[model samples]
Target: MINDKVLAIILGGGQGSRLHPLTEERSKPAVPIAGKYRLVDIPISNCINSNIKRMFVLTQFNSASLNRHIKDTYHFSFFSSAFVDVLAAEQTPENKGWFQGTADAVRQSMHHLLRHEFEYVLILSGDQLYQMDYDLMIKAHIKNKAKISIATIPVNAKDATSFGILKADDKNLVTSFVEKPDTSLLPEWNSDVSNEMKAQGRNYLASMGIYIFNKDLLIDLMSNPDTIDFGKEIIPQSIHEHKTLSYQYEGYWTDIGNIDSFFEANIGLTADIPEFDLYNKSKRIYTRARMLPTTKVSGTTLNKTVIAEGCIISAAKIEQSVIGIRSRIGDESTIINTYMMGSDYYQTLDDVNNSKINIIGIGARCFIKNAILDKNCCIGNDVRINGGNHLEDTETKTYAIKDGIVVIKKGAVIPNGFVL
Candidate 1:
């Protein structure tokens, strides 16, 4: 009786070690982006826009925030059959272990997956930043009669080492794959490379880690007891037995896995012309509705900045930054090239006066540049956080410097007159 044939499985809870302080208390997918939405929102919105209503988010590490976001933000209408669900990793008698890798995570949920009615499975990463209509790839798969299809992008040789390089024929069929390939191993443009690729001088096909698989083939491939990762094992092995197609994505796609990469992606948003556009009206990105009031700024010289609702700023020189929801900035503070993740809840005047703990806000006369302030942090007055010059690594119990970017940990309290 079921008509829909595709299933979406979003991979979350991947340790996110590279993005240290940000992922300390929450899962990677739950990490906030564009100052308004979590990284998970990107994939969920893509599914919704594409009319692929069924979804499952796989989670394991620090999933409290991630679970809350999915539950509260993705409630389907009573009249509709579409649903977004979370499948947390569990320790069953048959398997008592954490999700070993990407493939293993899906393999662990096989019991639940097989119970559903679906002909294909689409795997998407939770930390990637981009907009994609997966329905196109699904149609391409059916047209080619492919057992599997991987979404890919063309990258210069300088950027190819960070991704999985794939070799495909003119028919857009995958022939080989190499994960985190070296420049020496990147395939040169040959007769097999498609004309659309234009991989002539230094360009190569790099896997975006997006995949679509026939339900039966996916089930059979995950049947192995040793398959740990898709990029590491499954996809490479499948080249010999199945017809694996390649879906070339020419959009702006980025993987924010490391601290440096994360900072770049966020700061790049303030550019005159950003690489990724969040202002698309037809296919907009979706998020939870907080129902908060409008942001208020007074005597602040703001330029090229994006401020979320429920924020109160005063006499501050802010430029090229993203100020998140419920942020409170005192007078004469300067913020540049920064990302301030405001508070989860509003702190009234009574709450601020009564609590001995750190309330969420930056105090007066603070100068923060080239840094990120996590949620619910209390930055005291006269504090100077300048990471533009600090090249060495410093890990205090409260905060740390990774890749020359000062990361103020979540709920951290910095005393007055401190300098970093």
Candidate 2:
């Protein structure tokens, strides 16, 4: 096991408006990712792989699904002290307000955190994709004798505007930090991209929103009642006041913050050689193990797709997409460049024969292209959802087009012959 000096806290984030419809029913952390796993699983798996036994996920809005997933999936033996628990927002005598931001979420949960005897508190974002050995970051934090250590990744100037760009001194001590810098100002903020990073076409460093804070220092900083966010408020101020150091990460790291990034990440995983390799044996990503039957396919011409367990595909064409568990595709349907978050439960053959309920998936001869179909959605026959033909966002009662990606809201029913 990694040292007992570190405790991990995962920020589940506030209302996930950007990733709406997906977050409409559950918390952001509970949103399904890569077909099988939830967003919170990434950090929890990273901590487990790093040998850190204890983890606390802070949640405020719509946390029931997240709590249930954690309870059912993470079951350490009774003898082991290791635990993964959800610390949802509560109204205490001192603080009755909801979590204002990431820092405030942790600040409100400091009561439970203070009970544990730990030297460093590792803060992580729930909605990110990347495998990390946090023990290494802990070692570097200790070596630097830092009060706070922010993990950063080297990226090109073009891709750095969406993240919190940071500048470090010659010694790797953080000197300046800016949140979501303007695209036009990227050139001025471009710092020394490492030699190896430059060779990889990277020119600036962007924050991964992963930080390790000395226990006492984190407590002291959060004692301020006015502090709300770590990124926009605490971190920008801490760069000059505290011993904030920068730890470089060279691997694949992306914040799945919005629909465009989320869609790209899921679709990217279906690549011939994906940047984030899920098949890595040693560093594995763990999720809820469902006792579902094998996926059955019949005459379907599938290409570069990830179909989860218990799906039955019939004479359909799927390319460069991710199909979730228990998905059902009908005859002669064509799905391309799409991500379908599959249904929760399957409708049996008996149910289908009796016409008991609507089954989730594409109906006969439906054409879906460049879209994301949420869970438990029903598409009638001859329905066409081709977003390539439309670039502007549109919102109707049944569907919404965000970032040029057609999104069928959860549980929405598209009648036959419908076209977008």
Candidate 3:
């Protein structure tokens, strides 16, 4: 029963620097999403839903949290023919180096892959938020007999310069690829238009950085590459010789590369018609689910928010937020548009005005507007931090809330009645 025809390789090796302090302690894939799931959960869950079982997750850049997450969430035992594993970077005798780029990461792992009998390899990124039926793309690839198939979508022509744009034929065959080209040089520009002023219409198709390749072709190209990227090197060079097709996938796909985008993606999931649904029991998304009691909202006004297990919200007003487990919100505090991480002993018992109360754990607070409070923050009572328009005018490093909310560093405590 040698049925490993398709092998999925997820590239989780990069240290996402663009995400700043969020990635300071954990890998980008390990960053919490929607107060419950991690970034890597999207791809792994998609692979499971698509019926592609044999997979490997490549990790680098402080993978302790990510590795623990994978171990806890993905519990599939390997049989004689099927398995899912996480392969961190290792220094072998032949290649004692770190993964340099996207293409280089795959190149480093080719030794193990070549020994297995797989027909196709699906290469993907770990930082995207999307629900895709990759089997459909695979079927399209096999039907077209394409040596390579790239999943792509239409972007605004002006913004296309920021992405890898593909010039595909009517048959979806990729003719040319431009990686983040200067849009100002376009023929659509006029004399009054500065190169930076060129705006593209929403018609250009950009590569989604998701690729399906014939095992042989992928190995051959990776073996000999000058640059260490697929878009920058392999794909651009391969257009001359191979039948590379572009498969357009129109679904919810977002590259959550930065804190703002990451925040937006999580908030987007709570929409009335969300693109991705974690509540879908049939398409169960796997993550490290901690064992905690059900969330309790006693005398709290919660509207259009998601509260995970082990959370105690007593006498608070919460709206449009995602709350994690074991976090305690104090009475009389108003929480809005925020995300919290769950852990035991995040909050301490406090005496507020002759009454016993549980104060907000680290990073817990009343965010009256668009603000992101990172993990493990203890926000004290009588703290009125505004994320509204004029509240961002203040200039303080630790307390002055920027970008709609104050970001309290992990393990920091805000004393009671503290106003920033």
Using lDDT as the measure, the top candidate is 2
- Position 144, candidate 3: lDDT: 95
TM-score of 1: 0.95
363-390 in candidate 1: lDDT tens per residue? 9899999899999899998899998654
Ranking by TM-score: 2, 1, 3
Whole-model lDDT values for every prediction: 0.87, 0.89, 0.73
lDDT (10s digit) by residue, model 2, range 1-420: 335888899999988989986788899999988888899999999999898989999998899999999999999989987899899999999898899899999999999998888999999999999999898999988988899999999988778877899999888899998888988888777677668898877878898999999998999998997889988899998889999989999988889889889999999989999998889976899999999999999989999999999888884799999999888888999999999988888777787766546667888999999999988898888998898645688777778888889989888989889988
Native RMSD of candidate 3 (Å): 5.1
Q: Write down the RMSD of all candidates, one decimal each.
A: 2.1, 1.5, 5.1
Candidate 1 Cα deviation (angstroms), residue 173: 0.5
TM-score of each: 0.95, 0.96, 0.87
Report clash pairs, candidate 2.
Answer: none
**Clashing pairs in model 1?**
none
Flag regions of model 2 displaced more than 4 Å: 183-188, 389-391
Ranking by lDDT: 2, 1, 3
